[model samples]
Target: MEKGTFQDVNAQVVQRCREGDNRAQYELYKLYSKAMFNVSMRITNDYAESEDVLQEAFISAFKNLHSYKAEASFGSWLKRIVINASVNAVRKRRSELVPLEDRIAGDIPDEEYDDDTEWQVEQVRRAIQRLPDGYRVVLSLYLLEGFDHAEIGEVLGISESTSKSQYSRARKKLLEIMKDTHSMA
Candidate 1:
């Protein structure tokens, strides 16, 4: 579907939701739940925790639907909520969001290139899950979720430079994990 078409349908559903339509709310939830759950899972890295975060994010999004204002697509708006809730869940479990500030930004690696295109999606996913919380969150936000460094910084409450360096490190770690697994297999 075209982006504009979905946005049009979403606007109408959002309007109905703003009027307290339960079915419309359910429609929106059904439309977004799976993707949002993945968002939560990528950050929290725990199935049960991701489920809980998904439910909490939906409830919060519904309650705050009035504030949505259609400035962005409903999915984008809901995604921001899911990401924030997921980050919070991680923070609550870990006690803080230390941005792995040990290394200076100068240590951040440049993007690496690989000609091999044989990696399985599951392999990459497992590798991401193995990352430390700080690295995983930054990597997920910057890579999987399409948040730029500045946006990731805002969402993760770290400096933009920190987000960049953390992502570089995460990418490096992910490649190491994948390489080790391939060698073992």
Candidate 2:
């Protein structure tokens, strides 16, 4: 769990974890837990449930370490596990996902820019959290996780076009919310 242990997750660490090295497994968990917690909390909106999802994700990742190839970055592989854990947690709670039909196309007006931008990072994060589940997941996967539309489609089991469309709508809605808040201020 120390910083040096996670400085690099090279082939050695992967091999060790694959061979069931407990320290390597713990190192991997500590390396990615914070990022996974943020992702899970954004999806689940419940701190305790998000913590559960984070633990579940690490357990699943460790158990399946043998299947991991070096083709994708370890962070990316772990992200898939975390996202899946969040989605599964939501499904288990039976929280109805916001329907796709609610994201119809429309012209989203542009927001005004200022040299002295006063928006805080926390405000933007809160705005993102306010987005519906469908849009929030797509937005986080694309903008935050750096997943392309096709990769996102594959992960979410949606068509590529659907991923593109969802991303566009999510951006539009997020902009709308930010602008409204700016106006209020």
Candidate 3:
């Protein structure tokens, strides 16, 4: 099916779900659960917790379906809920106390890496998994999830500047991890 046709069918399913159709709800879940689960996992970094978050997010989305205007795609709306649930799960697990000084740092140069080095997807994913929670969340939201720094700041409850700084630091750290792994290989 063409991308547009697929989206149209999804929109119909979403409408049916809003009207409380169980089968349509299940169809929506089938279409989106894997991607949403990945989003939850990246944020929470625990398979069990990701599963919990994913379930809660879907429930929340279904309950609040009436409020979902088509301003964004259904997947985008669902992703926002998953991200919120995952972040809340992380907060419940541990307090993320980034120092004020760290958040206030002046504009750091965006690190440039050597274009000659080839990196594997598995290596990159593992490196991302190893990042600190603050860096990982910002990086994942901005790079993988297609959120701008401003949107990330809104979702994460940080200033836009802080979001940018965290993303910059995450990129540098990811590169370092990749290089180290490459050398050891």
Candidate 4:
């Protein structure tokens, strides 16, 4: 199906779901659950918590379906719900206190490095998982989820500069982890 046609069908399904059609609700979940689960997992960093967050997010989305305007695609709306739910779950698990002093790292100019090394996807994933929660969350939202620094700051309740700082630190840390892994291999 053409992209536009598929999106129209999804919008229709969302309308049906808003009207309390059980089948349409199921269809919507089937279409988005995997991607939502990935978003949840990336934020929560735990399989069980991700699953719980995904379920809660879907339930919340369905309950609030009446308020959903078709201004944005259903998937984007659902992703926002999933991200909010996952972040809430993580916050409930632990208090993320950002010391004011640490919020802004020194202005590090973006740097480029070239290396003749090929890294596996799993290696990169592992490196991401190893980052501290703040760095990982900012990095994932900015890089993997296509959120700009401003959007990430809004989502995470931090300043835009903080988001940029966290992303810079996360990138530097990720590279260090990858280099260590490569040397060991």
Error of 2 at 47 (Å): 2.5
lDDT computed for candidate 1:
0.85
Question: Using TM-score as the measure, what is the rank order of every candidate, best first?
Answer: 4, 1, 3, 2
TM-score for candidate 4 = 0.84
Q: Give the TM-score of candidate 3.
A: 0.82
Tens-place lDDT per residue, model 2, 95-178, is: 555442333223133455453444466558767866777788888888887889998888778999999999899999999988
Q: Report the C-alpha displacement of residue 89, candidate 2, in angstroms.
A: 2.7
- TM-scores for every candidate against the unseen true structure: 0.83, 0.75, 0.82, 0.84
When 1 and 2 are scored with TM-score, the better candidate is 1
lDDT of 4 by residue, 1-185 (tens): 77699888998998888788999999999999999999988887777889999999999999999888889988999999999998887677667564323422332233343543333665687678777778888999998899999999999899999999999999999999899988997
Please give the lDDT score at residue 116 for candidate 2: 41
Alpha-carbon runs more than 4 Å astray in model 1: 1-3, 96-119
Better of 1 and 3 by lDDT: 1
- Highest TM-score scorer: 4
In candidate 3, stretches whose alpha carbon ends up further than 4 angstroms from where it belongs are 96-119
Model 2 CA RMSD to the hidden true structure, in angstroms: 7.2
Clashes of each: 0, 0, 0, 0
Q: How far does residue 116 in candidate 2 sit from its true spot (Å)?
A: 7.7
Q: Poorest 10 consecutive residues of model 3 by lDDT?
A: 100-109
